[model samples]
Target: MSPALHRRLPLLATAAVLVGLYASGGLLYDGFLSGRVALNLLADNAALGLTAVGLTLVIFSGGIDLSVGAVVGFTSIFTATLVERHGVHPALAAAAALAVGGALGAGMGALIHWFRQPPFLITLAGMFLMRGGAYWISTESVGLTHPLYNRLAAYELPLGGRLGLPVTSLVLLAALALGGIIAHYTRFGRNLLALGGSESSALLMGVPLAGTRIAVYALSSLAATVAGLVLALYTGSGNPTFGLGLELDAIAVVVIGGTLLRGGRGHLLGTLLGLLVFGVIQTALTFDGRLSAQWGRIIVGALLLAFILVQRLLHERLGRRRDPIHTV
Candidate 1:
């Protein structure tokens, strides 16, 4: 393949996966077309889709955010506790959640840039710290009698008949569009790509390395806050442990979306497709009836591992030998 076409290989592969999964829905089971399928996917996978968008940006900057899941976990409590205790306006509460997430991300980015620490370690430490804080804030399960949360999350737009869509899906899509616009048309987006492609080169070229880097992490944290907010609303409660494994799920979608873990390569559109593909995997597996819930994790792990190996091979063949990349 020509170099230009080669860059599209992962996208083509992801499209194939999507087509195959959609076509196999018939073979998967009778309920494939049911409202249950759509609703479960919406409730369970939509937040992860939002989470994946930010990870796409962070990964494009050649850094992994191990703290996103924890941020979500913590934000669930923060949003809930604030609304319940302080009677804050819904919009203001939402903004506060995003600000908190962004601040945490910016702090980590500053640490990484100034102290020259690896993102993995920095984010890992952040993950533990956030989780501990969540526990400290609310050592017990907090339910969604919070009036503000109940209104936003429980509000439903009726589609027709007995079917209705949750407000959360709309929120997720809006955020996705916002992310796409920023990524495709903004200077910060260009700076991020440059940074990902070559940190030293970006610095040498004077790309506002610190500010943009900080912004990228802030965006990621902001995303996590959105997910946590919607999720808290949907579930009618907040728990420090609700989305224990969502960070991995978000990373998986971002990777499957064709974002090279090594930085400098990513796609917002691909992330959407990847989210649908993963949603189907879980829904289809559940529809099949013979598989246990744990099977979802096992199959996802295997799929992610296989994808990593394929990406590694692609990198080896097409990427420079000395320039390493993660099979994100």
Candidate 2:
């Protein structure tokens, strides 16, 4: 393959796998290929899609944020409590949640950059802190009966008969669009990719390392907050345990989307496809009543391992090709 084609092969493979999975599902189940199922994929996985989008940015910047799921849990409970007990408007409460998430992300980023701390450690601490904070605020699920949430839950943009996209899905698409632009067209995005490729090279090239790192984390947290709001709307309540294990899911989606875990390369569109693949798997399991839901995890784990191995092989091949003398 030509160099350009070789570089794009992974993304093409990811897209093909997604399409093939959907096709397989359609072949296996009647009515699985309908517009309703298509729309439901987006609707059901909107929060996850949004979270993956944010995680894509962080990964592209050569960083990871394990605190994303915890932030989602925190935001959900915090927003619900604000609207439920404090008589705060849902809009304002949602804004507050976003602010808290952004602040938390910024703090973590600062620690990672200023103190030269590991992203994993800082984010793990953040995860514990946010999850703990949610429990501290309320140990139980807080039901949200706010008019604003009710209206949002009911709102749908009709596509045709029995197939309309939910408000939450639209919100997710909007975020994806914005994230796409940032990843592809912005200076920050370019700097992020450069940093991911080689932090020392990026610094020598005059990329704003500190600001980019902090911004990436903040953006990730902001996305988590948005997902949290959507989760609240979906469930009509917020629990301290909301979004449990979602961070792993988001990371899996990113990796499955063909983004390198070490982070020099990734695409927003790939992440979306990855999320679709995840949704398709779950939906397929649901359609097959005989199969246990627990099987989904096993399948996902297997796929994740396969993808990681592929990445490792590709990385080794590229390294050899780039340094032929060293390889010899």
Candidate 2 lDDT over residue span 6-109, tens digit each: 76666787788889989999999999998888888988998888889999999998899999899889998999999999999998998899889999999999
- Estimate the Cα RMSD of every predicted model relative to the unseen true structure: 3.1, 1.4
Candidate with best TM-score = 2
Per-prediction TM-score? 0.91, 0.97
Please, what are the lDDT tens digits per residue for candidate 1 over residues 1-328?
A: 6876677778778888888887788666776877756666766776798788888888889998988888888988877777777776767877888888889999999998888899999989988988888888897777767566667666777878777677888878788898888887898888898999899999998899999888898889888888888788778877898668788999998888777899987778888878888998988887777888888888778778877787777767776634555322
Candidate 2 Cα outliers beyond 4 Å, as residue runs: 323-328
The lDDT values for all models are 0.82, 0.90
Q: Kindly report which residue pairs in candidate 2 clash with one another.
A: none
